[model samples]
Structures are given as structure tokens and as C-alpha cells.
Target: MTLSTDNALVVPHPLGLDYHISLQTPYCILCRYAVRPGEIIAAVFGHWGSPSYLAYTLGFSFPTVAQFEYGATVYEKSRSTSYPWLFCRRSDCYNCATLHDTSIYHIDCFHIISKNTASKRPSLRDIWTIASWTESLPKTRYQAPPDITLGAVADETLIDDHESILARVCSIPQELRDIIAQRCPESPAWRLVSALSRWRIFQPLLDPDIEIKGFSFDDIKSWCRRDGMVAGSGGSGKIRIQLDDLGVSRLDYVNDSPALPTAASRSQNAWFVVEEVSEMQEARIETKGPFMRIHKLPSFHLWDTPVPPDPALTRWNREITGNLRILRIRSIALKDITGLTVFCQHGAVRWIYPHHEETFPGPYSYPCDNSPSMAQLVPSAIESSSVIAIFFPLAKGEKISSVWVRRCEPYDDSIPDTLAVITTRGRFQLFGKYLCPTRPEVHFQQLSGNNTATHLLFQDVDFPFQRVSYFAAVSASVNNTGISPLAPSQLAQSRGFSWSSSFCYVSIVGLENVELIWLFRRQVPEGTPERDRLCLGMMLLYEDGTLAAAGNCRQGPDIDVQVIMLPGSIHYKISHKAGGVAVECATLDGGRDAILGDEEGWQSIDMHSRSEMRFWFDDSRTIWITSPST
Candidate 1:
């Protein structure tokens, strides 16, 4: 496309974006063009080869006040205690070209710093700075941070593409690697960021709908402390994890919480709960004697007197050369970790004691007797849990260039439940727990946008840990742009929801009220002659939807809602004129709130009781409340 203004380089890195910009108003570094939410077809200049090659958007840090190791809580680079901008380049590309004089680490390892001479204006990366929306510009596509956040669907509908993936699935070994490397629009987030730094871009965006700074669980623990008392890091007593009042109780538990039995209702979920849900109803942690658990390694023609410098391990170590990432996983249940084995791309190594003799299934062991869980025991995969083990091996010669992990709790969440072990044939062999528990079969509850209801989706609880993304919501939201994209995972091994390219706007009607009327998805094509555009109708009907909160980022004041507590009276549609769907009349009677728009181009809506439309939203699809069974 032709540019009216100079555009930033739209280059495609073999790797994805640097840090998927967490800030909302994502703009082009060069032109400051504000990318509209759900805008798919935009482009930037290339960093290297082509004009519009697809690449991930990189991130830069915003400079702010400082706290030095010498115990001074003050702004940095300041002249005296005031006149902060007395020295240094005063410009707005953020610390794109500066260095943090305070850090011991090299500039590359630290967040770029701004000098005392910088302007007082907030940087574009500032969370408080809401980005200004631009008028409709020439349609174009460029890789931006929003694009990386799964904020919008990258390409068009990919529903029918996965079936075609069978070709690569059964392709010759030589071709399989090529197939995996080729960019498949079906799951660009995973493929592009599979081995890259911005892998968080691939994580399934979960909910709360707020801006989350790069922080660990420990950080949250400190912030949530009401008394503002932090344990002394240098103290020598029992480590007091100062995380209390989170409702994570240890009162109720399974009688035998340590054994998985046949023909019993044992949900392997208790092991993964990091929230209030802490009960694992049916499934129990499989343990033996004083030993908590034992894992059997791949019994090949390998290792009898297994000790250090084993032949298989040394050989595999020699053959393996490239970036290596290890993700550690631990259960909420503490267990004594003993000897184990690590299977690499070229060979496998058994790490056992020198005097310990081993055979076919002899391997690592864990023994511990403690139960402190964060989630309540739910009998199904109705909610998100961490008790999963899988590996995503890179291409034959490709080492995992980047890996993304989350900080759960116990700090040991650092442990990875799954590993992408390299095998002799350079394949990813999962070396952790079995994908499914030893029970006959598992029936997981579906996520039907309702927390209290239950819908049994009787199928194998297949954890799409590798291909699917997972994340939680934020504190607040405006347009729900940052809401984690949701898909009906059980209905399909759904990678994500698909959408057609169009001019779409999302209006979250309620701010703090979690009642009916969640979002309004309006698509208006440009240049559609106003006279010809009859009733650009926007229908948003909600029923029995008790979502916690709502937000909208678009700039339109057409809607004015007032709430007065009355049975079945939750949402009220005053008016909306932005889309030519001006409300000609609105009335509340009998329990139904009816809205009638102008005749030339009208929009109609009804907001009422079970009549209150309870709906959930993703970037792509809309889920209406039809029945609790859904």
C-alpha cells in the first residue's frame, strides 16, 4: 500500500515480537498510528527484506521514578532533588537510545533508562495514557503488539484447515520438519512464537481484563498484603510465605488424597489448583509407601550401572547443540524428589545414586506428606488448572529459541509439569506424567460461561497444553480489548475462534454491573451510502448473564444507562446514535425493556429478566445465553 505518512519498518523476525506490548494504545513507533482493536489488515515497513513481511512486534520499556540500592527512593538522573530533566536528550521514543546508569547488569539485560533531561509528558508506553483513536485511514496491515496479544484473529476463518493438516501429519519425516516450520495461518501465534521470546502472545488470553505488569506471584503476594508488612529476606526462621486472606483454605480434603483408585471419582485437578478450588474429589495423588510417587523411564537398551558421565547421556549431550530451555513444574502437594532421568534429543540419562542398582522401570521418586492447595476441588476441567504435562519440541535442528512461563505460587511453580525432551531421532518425547490419569476414563465439565452450572462433556480430558493458550483476566477493562480470547474448548480441539475481516466495534454496555448485555459487536462497512444503508442494526440481547464487570474503549457517548434496583430490571438502553441506530423510543413495562430505532435505519433491543441476556465474548465469537445446559 501507499503511505500518507512514513510507516515503521514491518519486518518479520524468524522469531516473534520482543515483549508483546501490554499497554493498550498500541501505536506504530515511526508514525504513531493508533491501531484500532480488531483491525487485522495493516502493514509497516520491513526491517530487512520485503515491504510487508509478517513479523512480531517488539517491546521497549518506559522510564520512571527510581529506588536505588543505597536506600534512596527518588527519581533517577535528577539534578539535585529537583529539576529531573536537567541533563540528557529530551525526546519521546522512550529510552530507545539510553542506558540505565543505575543497573549493574549490561544495558541489554536491563530496561533502557531515560535521563533527567526528558520531558514530563508521559511516554506512549504509560498505562495511564489512553491512546487517541484515529479517523479511518487507508486500510493496511502491520505486525503490532496488539496483534501478538491474540487481541484479534490474525487471519481469516481456519475451521477447515486443520483437517488438511493430516498431510503433514503423515508426511515423510524429511517433510514433517518443513511442514512444522512453514507458517500456518491456523495457529500463527504458536508457530511464529513457538521458539521465540513473545511466546506469551501464544498463551490463551484468560480473563479479569486489566493491564498486568511483568510481575511474579511473589510480587502479587506483597501488594495484596493489607498490613504492608514484608517478611525480612535475611531472616532465618521457617520461611513465612506472607500470602494470606486469599481464601485459599486447607480445611477440606480427600480422605486418602494420595492414591488413585479404579472405579472411583478421582479428579486429578486438586494437584493443579492454585486458587480457592482445592478439592480433588475423585482422583488421588498416586503414591507408594513413604514414597510420594515414582516415574518409570523409557526402558530401552540403556543403563545398568547408571552414574555420572554415562555413555548415552554423554553421547546425547555431544549431539545436542543449540538453545535449551527447561521449564520446571511442581504439584501443590510437596513430595520428596529423588533420582530421575532426563531424555534429550540424542540420548537419555538416568540420574540415580552410585550404589543404587536399577532395571526396566527403575527411575526418579518423590516422597512428601503435605497438602496446601490454591484451588477448590471441582470434579471436572470446568475451570483452568495447572496439573498438565506435555512438551513442544522444536524442529529437528531447531532448539527452543524462547520459552514463556507463568509464576503460580509456592515459587516452585517454576517447575514444569511437562518437558519437550529431545530423543535419538530429534523428536519431542514428553518425559513427565501420563496425559490422562489411570482411571478408566475422565469426563470433564465444559466451560459454558456459567460458574455455578455443570454440563458434562463426556470425552477424554485432552489437555491442549501445547497448542492452546491459557491466561487469566485483569482487574478492569474499557473495551475488553485485552480480555483473554475464549473458545468452546471441549466442543472442538479448538485452537481459537475464527473471524472474517470487517470493520467491527465492541461496546461493553455495563461498567461494574455484571448483569445482562455484555457486548455489542457492530460491523459497518465504509462508503456504504447512508441512504442505501438501511437500519445499520446492532442487536445486543442479554439474558441471565452474571459476568463480573464490563468495559469499552471506543469513543461514543450515545449510550446512557441508569440502574434502579427492581426485579428483572438490570440493563437499560438509553440511546446510541453513532451507528445511525438512533433510538426513536424506549420503554420499560411488564418486565421487558423495548428499544425501537428510527424507521429509515433502525435497531431494536430488549433488556429484561431471564430476559437479561447473559453472554460471553472472545475477540472472534459471541456466546449468547440460551440455556444453562449450554
Candidate 2:
């Protein structure tokens, strides 16, 4: 057969002796020319250099060009090869198949004639030849090599090897090392390396083999005796004490808070056993049945020494171990001590003793030490205050069972009279009067379940030096086991006590043998309002005095009273009957007036008629009652 070289690769026919055959062509080689009746087609060879060399003996008659195109279309649409195409030696073939893996042998033009295109179809051997050729093709597509420049190669060379990189980093100024470390990627390996390096630098200062002596709570007697002090008694029998790395003795007790009534009563039974005391610290003892009272001792000086004066005492200017349960200060007069830190199990408490040149030494006394002083620890103030006591609850459902007491020179009257109690749930303030002039005491007890009560006893030394005491009760209700439900009268007695400027009002009503108490407070605006404002809060008081149903008040027909006061409506109303009080708002002479009844007896009030009435007890005290005309 004769062929054109424009779009074909002509090769010697492997089976034919005198005739030539084209192995690769754009059109079908078998159907490119019509076969004569006396001539025979030659065998075509493919994949010249590939492992898979397929040969097809072409002896069949050629079909119509249209029929050939139809078969090519069918083959293109139906054929799926597992192997990529073999790379051709031709330059054009390489470029055209740069990113493709299809066969470049032009088999579609040769053997892919559709069966329905002609009456005579190719034999089975011819079909097998095409299938085998497609199967052996390569599967991976070719990708072009990336362009590389001499500058890029030079830049890469500048990146030092691992050893060189480490050496360079180590050689930099010490200050810059931290800057580099901060910019480094946050990988575990990098972090470990950094930590190890830091540890290496500080190795000389650390005592790797430092020995700490372990001791049980019972053994504390021995340690206290070493410092010539008596041991206290009545701690948890299961507790153990250990001397920590910082040369401070620590008592390790169970982190769990003491159980309710059982633990509370058990604590009272325990007391420190003191046989004798030093002259620097005094101990007052009174034995009355199982109870003993001790007078607070005055302050003493603390010095920096290898061993503490008392092993039971906290370290000076160092953080106490976090696991300490009970911290008993032998000297309760904490007026001049500084840098004394105590870490409670639930929180931390630090003392800032008042700064005085005569009371404390000058900075030159401790030249090498850089620890902060009491004046520096707190915000700049003329005088400092010592945190005398701290109380906190230990259990999950427990109310704040803690109190913090501070003693100052009583110069700043702006200092709040209340102490903020922080618990796991939140924080609240407890306001009370001083119980003692020298020592203020606070006691917390769980009445029932999670319900707690606090008793504060302190002398009011502000003016006439009178004795004062306060009792506060709160309900946590985490567990069920305590006080009975609260009555309306009980709730009235508990409400309306405010140390802050916020005004509180309580109204009680009885219906169907059930008493209900509603508490109301005026929302004070930050700035003076052009008109008066009124807001109401309703609450249901249970028999145990716990408040519930607290929500905003809505005006409706079912409501007993809708309290709304306008501007210039400030007035007081006294009930004729003792202990009978109410808040009423009415329009008198086309002006609104709100009246709040006082807690004292109101026998002097004349309420016979619903008219505008005013009572002047003195120049400073006045009472007014106004009834709107209906």
C-alpha cells in the first residue's frame, strides 16, 4: 500500500517482504486504502522501544472513510486504559502528550471501525491487537521541570547546616535569644530544647540533690520543739507535713472541704496544745469545759535566716505551699508585719503592713535583696493595712464560709465597712460592726443543708466606742436538709438593711392564710433625672427566709398595688398601728406623692380622712401623707 508522510510514520512491514507499512498515522491505517483482490495487507508494529510490543497482521478489506470515522468516535468514547501511553520518539508527539498519557500510535484510525458501520467486520485477532496495545500504555502524566536561577541557588547555600545554625544562634547576644525564641514555630521539640537550655543555664543555682525531711502531723511536735516552741493540737489525724524545697514547713491535708455539721462540730473539739511561750510572743489561756480562749499577741520582727524561728510559722516573703489546710498565726496583732504571704486552699491572701520609717528598717539594711515591700506591693497609699483574717468555703454547694479582716489606722472613712466573700459560685459583701477594739472576730456556721449563717462581732470604735454585732444568713440549697420555710414577717425583718446608699423597700400581704412579701428598690440613675423614676421587684419569701420568685413587677388588675412615683414625690408615711408599714403613691392637688412608712411606731399619725396631710416632728424630720381624691 502507498502512504503520505504528512501525518504518518512509515516503517518496514515486519511480515511483508516487498511492501512497506505505516505503523503510526492520524487516520486508520487498515482502512486508509482499499485492498485489491490479489494483494495482502502487512503486519503493523507498535511500541518500538517499550516492553509491550504489539503487532497486528492487517489482511482485511478497507471500509468507507465515513465508517472509519464512526468507529474512531466509538473507540474514543468507550475505551478506558489502565496503563499510560508509551513515549514516542517523535518531537511533536512528546509536546502534544506532555501532560497526557493516551496512546500516540493512532490506533483509532486503524482498527476502531464500528461494527454497525459495514457489513464485514474486523476479525477477533484485530480487536485483540488494539486492546493489548491500549492496556500496555503508561498511566502517569508528564510534568515539566521547574525553572531554577543562580540567585536562588546562592540563597539556598546561605542557609547554614544544623550545627552551624545552632552555633550561630548560641553566639548571638543573650537578650536577642529570647526574641528569636518568641518568633520560633510552636513545636514540641523546639519547646523542649528551649526549656533544656534554660535549665542548663540555671543549673549552678539549683540544688539537684536537695534533701527535704518528711514528717507527719504528729511529728510536728518534734519540729516545733526544735525552734523552742510548743505544738498545737487537734488537726486531722490523717494529715502529713513536709518541709518543702524553699525551706518552709507545709502541712498536707485532704483538699476536700470538711463535711457539714459533723466536721464543724469536730473542729471545735480540736485545739493546739501549748505548754509554754517565748517572751516575744504571749499566749493567753482560759480553760472553761472543752473550750479555751486566747488573747491576741502583739507583733514581732522577722529576719532572713537559714532556719525559721518557728517551724510552724509561714516563711517570710515566700509563698506558702498550696496544700496547707489550717494556718494558725501565733501572733494575731498584724499591724507592722510585711512580705508575709499565705496561700489558702481556695485562694491567696497577702498582707500589706502600714509603711513607717520608724517601724521598719531602711532599704540599705537588705542590699542584696530585691523583694517588694508592703508599700510597693499595694497601690501607693499614705498608710498600709494588714489582712487580719480570711474565710472561704471548701465544699461545692457551700456558701461563702470565709471572711477577710483588715486593720488600718482608721484614717480613710471611704474604706468599705463590708468584707467581700469570694466563693466558687460568685462574690458577695458582708457588712457588720466591729465586735472588739483590738481583735475583730467572724464566725461561720451551716445551719442546715447548704444554708449558712455568719456572725460578726466587733466594737464600733468610730465614735463612742460602742460594742456592735451583726448576723447574716444565706441559703445555697445545694442539698436538701435544713431550716424550715420562711414566713412573711420573718422576711420583713430581714429586708431593708443596707450599708450602701441604695434604698430598699419591703411590702407584706396576707391572703388565704399564705403570707407573701414583695421587695422594691428604686433604680438610681447615674445622673440626676429630669423626672422621677420608679421600678418594682417582686419576691416570694419561703418559711426558711429564702427568697424566690424574684422578677420585675408588671402592672395589671391582679396586682395589689402598682407603685409609680413622679418628680417631687418624696414623702414618708407612719402607720397608726405598730409594725404596720406600706408604700403608697397618690395624686394630691394634681401632684404625685410617694410615701414610705418607717419601722418605728406611728401613733402620732392622723389618718381619719383621705386628704393631704403633713407632720413636722422637728426642723430636720417631717412626715407627710397624701390621699388622692376619688
Identify the leading candidate in terms of TM-score.
1
After best superposition, candidate 1 residue 162: deviation in angstroms?
65
Candidate 1 stretches with Cα past 4 Å from truth are 1-561, 564-587, 590-630
Give the lDDT of residue 459 in candidate 2. Answer: 14
Name the lDDT of candidate 1.
0.20
lDDT of 1 by residue, 51-148 (tens): 12232212212222121111111122312223321222222211121111110111111111111122122232221111100100010111111122
For model 2, residues 1-630, the per-residue Cα lDDT tens digits are 332223112222334322212111222222212122122233443431232323333233222332332121111111123321122333232112222112221222222222223222344333333322222212111111111111112221222233533335445665555555544322222322332232222222222243323222333332321242235442442222222111113222332322211111111111122212232133232212111112232222211111112222111111223211112222221222221122111011232111212211133321011224322222111012221111111222324333333222242222222222333233222222222222222222222222232221111011001111111122223233232343112111222222223211112211111123332333334563312223233333224322222122322222233333221232333433321222333333233322433433222222223222211111111122223331
TM-score of each: 0.20, 0.18
lDDT of each: 0.20, 0.25
Worst 10 residues of 1 by lDDT: 131-140
